[model samples]
Target: MDQIKLTMKELKAFIILWSTQSISTLGSSMTNFALIILSYQRYESALVTAMLSVCTYVPYVIMSIFAGAISDRWNKKYIMLASDSFAAFCTVFVWILLRNDRLEIWHLYALNALNGLMNTIQQPAADVTTSLLIPEKHYQKASGMRSFSNSLVNIVTPMIASTLLALTNIQTVILLDLITFVIAFLALLFFIKIPEIQKEKTTQETVLQSAKNGLKYMKQNRGILDLILFLAAINFTASMYNAALPAMILSKETGGEVALGVINMVTGISMLVGSIMVSLSPTPMSRVKVILNTLLLSMSTENFFLAFGNTLPIWCVGAVLGWIGIPIMNANMDVLFRSYIPLPMQGRIYSARNTLQFFTIPIGYFLGGVLVDRVFEPFMAIQPAQGVFVMFFGTGKGSGAAFLFFVLGVLGVVTCLVFRKDKNIRQLEQ
Candidate 1:
């Protein structure tokens, strides 16, 4: 009876945390969507747009290694609260700048970097808190809930921001974000209770040493290391596609922000369906196989359609198919990490994993931007009237990005196939 009661209490706490955090995430997503549209409108350069992501990720990748160790040592709740407060302040600052007409591309870049730094601290703390609050058996369900909220946010944020931009301005979208943040902040401060983790005090360890220990742990776990490396490769390719996507759609003669929003909404619905499926289904016998197979399916079909298809309907079809597998892949990956790593070490290990898996993203973003702006766009612009590239990708502004997507699709599939046969990765199933 006691164990059952404890389980119920923990589950309730997780639900509270999840709900509040999801609300906060929705706000953040709205601000991000609005900003992306704003940036693209002002500068009209893929590199400039991609730089925003680069700035955010550079700081995050740098800070995450140390932040994870700190999260393990500090009060997770306080860390989260502090991080959220700072992030809200950044949003407010952006609103102020816009109101004063002083906002510039560089300002957004700097603010995104600050937000990224805060997220490094907040993410590990939040991850640890969830691990502490939820039972091990419920990890997959919890992951699904997280994915559902994210997909819902993805669906709504684009619609909301685009509508608000049409009706009012970017300021209104930012204001709505602020309102949502306040609600989430108050709920987290007043309602959620995170259980304390008791740590064994055998010897004192420096932050550097703690961070290194995470690396050492991964070094020892060959399977986990291999998995992270494989993800790094995947992230690289995905980031390039993502960085180019906005420019691709906007540059098309028939495409615009509303078209992009519709595609995003369709993609989100597919992801929502996938999340629901994962939430209701039993744990798979081999998560490794599921991850690889889904990656194969998503990468091949989505990119193929997107690269070749010229119409919005075709783009929507690709978007939906591409996104459905993401939630399932993410849920299984979360379960794998939660199951394999010890609760106490999860913060550091997760941090380490983040560093390894995301390090390629900034590079990919930068290269994608440069390629689209300098290389591919110019090359496509000068292409002769008839060829395989022109026939498949269509000529003009968006064609370069289309060609890049095709390349990424081929590379993604090859990467998955090569990694699928790795002995270390297969061993994770055991």
Candidate 2:
């Protein structure tokens, strides 16, 4: 059998999309990274950062169904281009407000909510569009390119945000974010031409009936549901880490931005390396396997990594391992799902998936806040070492909270692993 590869033509089309997506993501990440730093610097509380984290996911929980419906009815390419432009304008306006030193935490919340709404529209559209642009044989390479672009954006922009925050202030970072999105918008508008993906006919079905049909299909295909649930658990678990990682590093006591930046850079580098490895060693293993293995290592290592803070080498090694493993699990799943689901209803299915799958992230954030600020702090008062405020690793009594997340992943992985014998798991790479 001849191996399928992406032609230069298709590669170019995908890259145009990928590059634009990367630029937009880079900008959003900068704001995201900056917002946490800003909140921590000013508020000096982990609670605020956790709120910001929760706000980021709240929109995903809210508009996921509507986002899916729009993608199903509309042209995704135009949606991508328009949403980027709209989001850029929102960023620009937010940047301007911040520039005058009128920045309020509420401003961050409101703008992020708007940004999340845009993302609710944009991300699913882009997710489905990958299959529209590239041939099946080329998925691994195409996926690598996307992963490469994501890692590279982090490599470039995250540190830039870090450096800018240190050297100047929030205003400049906001401006750069505004500019990057504009550049991304231009690339999508002028360079890419994605043909519309038509939805399958379900002429007689009611709305609930259509949703039921998709749900029934997924129910019968237990492996896909298993796959989705496993990742959902992992994502909910990881949300705690993501919500707190930067704060944990800064901590005024453990280390600071430099430490956070180092960890971030390591994570980005790990993702970069993982993308390359996946393309080289594409496999038929259930993506659940890949997710479980990486996240298991990540969750387990995270439980104990702070204990080794004196050993910079060990912490660095752990960071890279977690970073690489998690993204591989993620990238592979996208490929697998696309292969299994038909192109037409991908929007609606993914919409429902997004809505259901991410329902817990905000809960994770809110729970993290309550644990860190409310529970952990009180526990420390009761017993000093039991609730020790170790500023070095940013673990409060909330350390237990973090551990709980890791356990969630571990338990979820165990439940999903039993499905290895399921036929759907065996057929993804075909």
Candidate 3:
């Protein structure tokens, strides 16, 4: 039988946890934004900024499977607290380094790697805890709430970080993140109680064996595996698009840091609206339809915007239409995961799935940087007014990145259309 329906007690607990986490997330977002801006200003290279993603995701990719096993065997609540505590310490370390004027690119990279490990450890535990707390029926609504929090952070962080940077320094931003972490850790430690999942006897299975079993399960379930592979591929393109976007905004003669912040705020507001829409609506019977259709709409609109939009206002219109699909699609995907996967296996399965799905993100980051810095930049740089490349992507600093966005957008749409025809994916929830 499914877990109990959503109750007042559960809702209240979830709210407390959600609120605390959201605050921490907002703080982290601000720090990350500041770091990106700092990195760009220091190096003036897209590759350096993109390499930050590599350092962050490499550890996450390596630890995901192991972290899942650990979460399943251990107490999730404690694991979450420990992870947050470690992350808070890392933030403090960064703050100290900055204060000492000893912070460097390599230091940031190493810290990002450590932070990724902490996040990897926390992700499965935190995710399954949410699933355990909320009933099956409310899964979509809960996901919407999560998305809402994320969008709210994205909407506010850029402007906040910019203001803080202008007034004080990056260390001040890091200090705020440290404070949020403490608040979140205390809330989880004191008030939230996560229920344990019932596990079958596996007396002989070791942690490594358990991870293998998770992989074996995926191999047997072709539908789930196929879905994971599809997402991984599409995510590669999406990552490239994401990594290149700020460059597109900031590289142009007319575009600047302010323009980038404003664009992000607009995108965040659109995502917030989408999450609200999903929360108000009933869960669809066919989640597959929701996922695929949203993917198609987002990819098409985003690419269109990047390829043709010459001004910030034009980009803003595209961002609104393109970003609106993300929360709806993500909420439905979460509902599917909860409905199909057994609770006991979720920690392991989700971790393994995450590794597979995000394995190519680093590659995407590298590829995005290279495409913009080497091939597209040179190609666009030499173009005349009537040249084909300039005609398609305009002629300027960000035009190369814009061209890359167009290409990725086309690829994303094609990937979604192909995945739509996959019998296994269509019947995955069944």
Candidate 4:
């Protein structure tokens, strides 16, 4: 009876945390969608838009090495609260700048960098808190719920932002973010209590040493290391696709912001479907196979169709097929991580995993933008080459990006196949 009561209490806490955080994510997504529109309109360069992601990711990758260790040492709840407060302040600053007509692209870049840094702090702490709240058996379900909220935010934010932009301005979108932040903040402050983790004090070990220990642990656990490395490769290809998609869609004569929004809505719907399936389904026994198989499915469908198809309907079809596997793969990955890593070491190890897995993303974003703007786009504009490339990727403004997507698709598919052969990666199934 007592165990049942305790389980219900923890589940209730998790639900509250999830709901409030989802509300916050919805607001943040709206602001992000609005900014993407504003930035693309103002700069009219793929590199400029991609640089926003680069700035955010660079700081996140750099800070995560230490952030995880700090989270292990500090109180998780306080770390999350502080990080959220800082992020909210950054959002408010953006709103003030917009209201005063003083906002520049550089300001957004700088603020995003700060926000990314804060995320490094909040993410590991939040991960640890979730582990504390939920039983191990429910990790997959919790992850699915997280993915569902994220996908729903992705779907709703664009439509909302597009409507608000049509009706009002960026300021209104940002103000909405502020309102949501307060709701999330109060909910975490008053409604939820994260259980305390007991840690042995090592007075002699420095923070840097703790971070090093995390790396050492990963090296010793070859399966985890291999998995993270594989994810790094996957993230690289995915980042390039992400950076190119906006340029491709917006550059199309027929497809504008509304078309892009519709495509995003389609993608989000697919992901929501995937999350629902993951939440309800029994946890798979062979998580490694699920991860690899889903990657193959996602890479093949999304990039292939996006590369060849020019029409919005074709893009929507590709989007649906490509995105559906993501939540399924991610939920399994979370279950594997939570089940394998010790709860005490999870904060540090998870951060280390993140650092390794996401290091390639900024590089991918930068290279994707540069290659599209300088190399592929210009090359496709030439005569004989344009004629040849147009046969495969249709001629026009986005043809260059389309060609890049084709190359990335091929690479992603090949990478997944090669990684699937690794015995060490497969050993994680045991």
Candidate 4 local Cα displacement, residue 277, angstroms = 0.6
Residue by residue across 4-28, what tens digits does model 1's lDDT show? 6766676898888888788888888
Off by over 4 Å in 4: 1-9, 202-204, 384-386
Q: What tens digits encode model 3's per-residue C-alpha lDDT throughout 309-357?
A: 8888988898898889899999988887777778888888899988999
Candidate 1: where are CA atoms >4 Å away?
Answer: 1-10
User: What lDDT tens digits, residue by residue, belong to model 4 across residues 1-430?
Assistant: 9976765675899999999989998998899888988998898789999999999999899879877778888888888889989989999999889889999999999999998988998899999999999878778878999999988988898899899999998899989988999999999999998997776663236778868888998999899899999999999999999889899999988688999999999988999999999998986879999999999998888898888888999999999989999999999999888888888888888888879999999999999999999998988888475376889887768889999999998999999999999999999987
Structural similarity to truth (TM-score) of each candidate:
0.97, 0.87, 0.96, 0.97
For residue 116, what is the lDDT in candidate 2?
75
Candidate 1 all-Cα RMSD:
2.0
Scanning candidate 3 in windows of ten residues, the lowest lDDT window is 1-10
> Per the 3 Å backbone cut-off, how many clashing residue pairs does candidate 3 have?
0
CA deviation > 4 Å runs, candidate 3? 1-7
What is each predicted model's overall lDDT from 0 to 1? 0.88, 0.69, 0.86, 0.89
- Residue pairs with backbone atoms closer than 3 Å in model 4 (clashes): none
- How high a TM-score does candidate 4 get? 0.97
